[model samples]
Target: MIESDIKRYELLLDLLQKSKKEQDEQNNTLDQKCSSMINILILIITIQCGIYANVALLNEIASSEIAIIIKVLLIITLIGNFIALYFFIAAYYLKDFEGMTNEEDIIKYGENNTNLETIYKEISVDYKRTIEENKIELSKIDKIKLGFKIVTLTTGIFVLTIIICLEILI
Candidate 1:
């Protein structure tokens, strides 16, 4: 029975470690996605500026219906990209549980003349709470990522449509 209990505790510890590692990996992924979104936003802004410059200076399609349409599409693209950027920025702000617990804390807790079972209970409660908080954060990040992706897709389609219209007009 004692051996079985020890094995169970060991298994729990291993599972906790694995969970934390997975969360770390997920955090890294979220960070990368946010960075990529920022880059996309920059690119979109640059392209929009170029399009406006061409339309304003060249006067190729100025004072035409196509110009109006292109301007609307540009506005839509900008709004979509801005919304996606907002979500990515918000996701970036979400905190991750890194180094929330330390070995020294565990050692100090253990040295308080607590039995193994009590220590385990305390650690387990803290671990579960931390895990729950992390899960909530991850969920929020995922939702924001989903929103960002949808906006990005919509923006891409709008840009493509605008390009086709411009080509026909030019």
Candidate 2:
């Protein structure tokens, strides 16, 4: 019975380690998505600025209702993109994650505590603690996902605005 219990605890530890590894992979993917969204936003903002400049140069824009609407849409696009950019930057903030038990600590525990069950219990507790801490770090996933949604919606609006302005100019 004692041998089976030890084996069970070992299996539990392995499962916990696997879960932690999955969380780490997810965190890395979230970071990459955030970075890519930031780049897309920057590009969109730059293009909007160029379009605004070109539209401003048109003498008819100053006097037309359509011009006012286009300018308003452009302003909204800029503001939305900037807000999304802020979210991505916030999501990019590095989290200090708790790591697994250090080898030194394990060695120290081993020297003082000869009981196998006691050591396994302590290590399992440590692993669980780190996994919870990592879950906290992963909370930023929602913020980045929200930012991506915002960028997608705003980009669609921006495209429509550009099409309208182009039609008017031509």
Candidate 3:
């Protein structure tokens, strides 16, 4: 019975470790995406704002035909970009995820000459806790990423519209 329990824990530990590895990989992927998207958003916003400012200055006359349209488009674009940026920033800045058993725990286990079964049980329990915590965090990030994606799509459309407006109407 003892050997069987130990074998079970060994299997459990292996599975939990695999799950943790997958989650870590997922977290890294999302982090990279968020970082890249933020940089691109910043660049696009900067360029768009610069264009809008220059155009507004040149078309300062109150009677100018395209001034009002340009102002409206710029306002919508800014709002969309702002919302998308919020999602990205929130996801990117989320709390750090819990990881597997730390080095100190390993050292303590070694020094205490912990039984194999005890070690497996302790490590597995720790892995389970970390996995649960990571799951919650990942779920939150997934929701935020969805929001970012939708807003980014809408914002991209608005930006393209603004470009078209600037090109043909300016």
- lDDT tens readout by residue for model 2, 1-170: 39998998898888888988898888788788888888888888898888878777555554577777888888888888999999998988767788898999889886886577777778888888998877845448677878878888888888998788677667
TM-score per model over all chains: 0.76, 0.86, 0.80
- For model 2, the local distance difference test gives 0.81
Candidate 3 C-alpha lDDT tens digits along 1-170: 38889889989999989998998888788777778877877887787688767666536543466667767766677777777777787887785777678899999999998899889989999999998887747555775667577666757766675675657555
* Candidate 1 lDDT, 16-96, residue by residue in tens: 767867877877787787778778777876787677566544246455675666666667776777777777777777775
Error of 3 at 170 (Å): 8.5
Greater-lDDT candidate between 2 and 3: 2
Best-first order by lDDT:
2, 3, 1
Candidates' C-alpha lDDT:
0.69, 0.81, 0.76
Q: Local error of candidate 3 at 44, Å?
A: 0.7
**Which residues of candidate 3, in runs, are more than 4 Å off?**
1-3, 57-65, 136-139, 146-150, 153-170
- Name the 10 consecutive residues with the lowest summed lDDT in model 3: 55-64
Best by lDDT: 2
